[model samples]
Target: MIDIKNVNKFYGQGDSSFHVLHDINLSISEGEFVSIMGQSGSGKSTLINIIGFLDDEFKGEYFYYNHPIHEYTRTQFSKLRNQNVGFVFQNFKLINTLTVADNVGLPLLYAGEKRKAIKEQVKDVLEAVGLPDASEKKPTNLSGGQQQRVSIARAIVTNPQFLIADEPTGALDSKTSREIMTLFKELNQKNKTTIIMVTHDEKVALQSERIIQILDGRILSDKKVNA
Candidate 1:
């Protein structure tokens, strides 16, 4: 579903140049659940941003589906990202003022969807993430796990083909982290949503089907987990 080849990212030009990624080549298949692991300053997040199309100022080719990504206009890029990709950040990016339902339905609002349809889709996703009763509540009222679930629901409500989670469980406790991982597994199995997550936790990484470890702006290892 996504292919990145010979991608290199530099932070600045000339004397300030700091390479964040080095000829990184990666391909994520449809319905694949992949985890990325790396230490501090290892360029994992940089690569994630590149793959997510948030950092377009990189060096190399990124092909989404079949078309070259850079060829798309800003409006077209926005639409494709909205339609195909969803993101969950380390810090839950939910608006403090909006209700959970409102936050989850935000993406659909941008798509110009009908309110009734948006409500239905939001409710379904909330239920899928095991937060049916919390939709009317605000993010501040929910626990860490619930907030992350809200973030997840918000990401998947549009039925996006890909979900990119960066340190999704960084703020949660062990039990909550496990619950979120279980929820992710169920989503992957049931809906076939392609998932790519970046994490520093070993147990969390193990939940994924495959893990790729990065270091010094390059891939160090890639391995499949035992079922």
Candidate 2:
């Protein structure tokens, strides 16, 4: 449901300009699981930011389900992002002060959903993420894996069109990472949730249906996994 054509990103201006992405051309269908693999400063993050509607200061065309994303105004872009995309981060990004249910319900709360509905939706997502009993607990009391699960629950609670997972497994142990990947796969397969994940680990990338490797601000390779 995403299409990007001839996209280029730059920082600074004039003679001091630094190009971050080089003629990026990519398309991702609905429900596809794709991973972006890159080292530090390879511009993978920039590309995903554009895809996720988090960055609009770039040159090129982006079409989301045939809607020209580049033509949206700031308010429209922000609304579109809120309505369509969910994000998971390496650091879990949870608030220690809030209950797990409260954390998971933030997006719905921001969207003006009622507390009763938000509570039900939060419960469903927590159950889906294997954290059915975590609603009353604080994030600080959870293990890293449990915290990540809470983050995933928060992301999916909105029933967003797609998910942007930036280094979701970067802070976990190998076994925990595997469990998280398994949860992601279940979401993709059962819920038809499209996922665009950025990761540096090859093993993590391999778990996705497709892998796109970036090097020096350009796409190095795009290939499907054997499985």
Q: Kindly list the per-residue Cα lDDT of model 2 for residues 51-126, writing each as its tens digit.
A: 9999999999999999999998888887888889998989999999999999999989888788887788898899
Q: After superposition, how far is residue 169 of candidate 1 from its true place, in Å?
A: 0.8
lDDT tens digits, residue span 107-180, model 1: 89888897777888898889989998998898999988899999999999888989999999998999999999
Off by over 4 Å in 2: none
Q: What lDDT does model 2 reach?
A: 0.94
After best superposition, candidate 1 residue 123: deviation in angstroms?
0.9
Q: What pairs collide in candidate 1?
A: none
Off by over 4 Å in 1: none
